[model samples]
Target: MSRILLVYTGGTIGMIKNPETGALTAFNFDELLSNIPELRLLEHKISTVSFEEPVDSSDMDISDYIKLAELIEVHFEDYDGFVVLHGSDTMSYTASAISFMFENLKKPIIFTGSQLPIGDLRTDAKENLITSIQLAGLKERGKTVIREVGLYFEYKLYRANRTTKINAEHFEAFESSNFPPIAESGVNLKINHEKLIKPNLRKKMLVHKSLNDDIMVLKLFPGLSQQTLSYLFKMPHIKGVILETFGSGNAKTDDWFVSLLESLIERGVYIVNVTQCVGGAVHMGKYATSERLKRLGVISGGDMTTEAAVAKMMYLLDKNLGPKVFKTIFETSLRGEMN
Candidate 1:
């Protein structure tokens, strides 16, 4: 039987109604099997580990990212695959961060969560949890099937970094617009073999624990304040910025805005230009408005989701690459985050 590790970092999936007050509370992960009796029917050997204190997804930060990476590194060889139960709110960001944290990853790291508390009537937690475990344990010819980070939600499995949480109330909260689902569930689970990532089998898994959170996002809007932009850009502590631009990475052509970005680039601040739209790529030079940004050394984020761009920047920022080197690397596809 395949061995799967269930890492519970807390989410609606782990919550149950308190008998005394009927309020939702995190269930004991130690009693996981008892709480979800259907898990007893699975043939895989499932074991769980949980945080001492459950953290709301809004409170999740880089410290939690390091902790989760360390946990996986410690038991990398003991388990065939891992299933992480995370809050749906920030699940995409966390999953994207984890994807960039590891090198030569050859085992499944399936992140799953639910919209409603597990104890609620018509809760979607049970299916999500059960299917995630099954996917984690899937193998062929003595090798794991999925060799990358994936987010499993509803009936679809998407590349973790490519995903974005598009809805707050719907059970189908996440969407991967630039890429297709690598796998899907129907009457029978199906794997899209052609879409799977193939890692070099020769390299051993390496986990990157160092991540810099000294970056910020500057989203452009109609009549965005130049005063506010100047104030934020003037901050010495800021190392990188994700510039969310208009369709196909277009932006205002005002001299002050252009000068501000140019000055920031000259001062060694890495700026990445990503499209504000969900489905398309940032073709920086395709439009005149974005041509200036391309010439100003703003890295084109291509088809990468904002969550992935943010996580990728954090991971790369810690490496301390030079501006030119960082721009080149960021534009290239690392972990299939871009085309």
Candidate 2:
């Protein structure tokens, strides 16, 4: 039987309603099988490991991501696949970070969570949890079907780094604006084989745990003051910045603005230009406004979501590469996060 490991890192899906107060409280993973007995019907041996103190997704940080990576590394050879139960709010961030951490991953690492507590009568938790596990366990001829990190929710399986939580009140909370869904589920689970990421099974899995979070995301707006820009760029220890620009990566061409950015680049701070539009890539020189940014050595985040860009920057910064090398790799698609 296939063995699947459920790593619960805390989320709405693991909460139970209290009988007296009606407030939700963290539930025990030991009761998972009993709570959802349908799991027994699957032809897989399911096991779980949860955090000692369940962390709210808001508090999730780089250390927690490293801890998760270490957990999977320890049990890598024993399990066929792994499912991470994470909160929907920051699921994209955590999922994107973990995707970069694991290199040459040959097994499925699916992240999933629910909008409501599992104990709620109208909860969408059961379906998400069950389907996520099934997707994780899916294999073909002794080979895993999905060999990369994915986020599963509302009958859709998306590349983890491509996903963004787009809703707060709806059951379908996540969306991959730039990329297509890897798989879909209804009466049948349909795997889009062509869209799945192909891993090099010949290479051993390498986990990168060192992530530098000394980065900032600066969203550009009309008439953004030089004072504000100066303050941000002058901030000490700010190693990188994800500049969320206008459509097709357009930004102010004001001389001061361009000069400030150039000054930062000269100071060894990497700046990446990403589009604010949800569904488009950054074309740095497509317009005159962005041309100066291109000339100033700003890297283009082509069709990459902000979450993915942030995670990618963190992963790359830890490598301590030179400015030119860093720009080249940042523009390249690492872990299929960008085009």
Per-candidate local distance difference test = 0.92, 0.93
lDDT tens digits, residues 1-339, model 2?
689999999989999999899988998999888998888888999999998888899999999999999999999999999999999999999999999999989999999999999989899999999999999999889778999999999999999999889999999999999899999999999999998999877988899999999999999888899998898788889999999999999998888999999999998999999889889899988889998989899999999999999999999998979889999999999799987
State which candidate has the highest lDDT. Answer: 2
TM-score of 1: 0.98
Assess candidate 2 and give its lDDT. 0.93
Error of 2 at 7 (Å): 0.5
Model 1 deviation from native, Cα RMSD in Å = 0.9
Clashing pairs in 2: none
| lDDT tens digits by residue: candidate 1, 1-339 | 789999989888889988799999888888888888999999999999998888788889999999999998898899999999999999999999999999889999999999998888889999999999998999889778999999999999999999999998898989999999999988998999999999999998889999999999888999898899999999999989999999999999999999999999888889999989989999988989999998998999999998999999999998979888998999998888988
> Looking at model 1, which ten-residue stretch has the lowest summed lDDT?
50-59
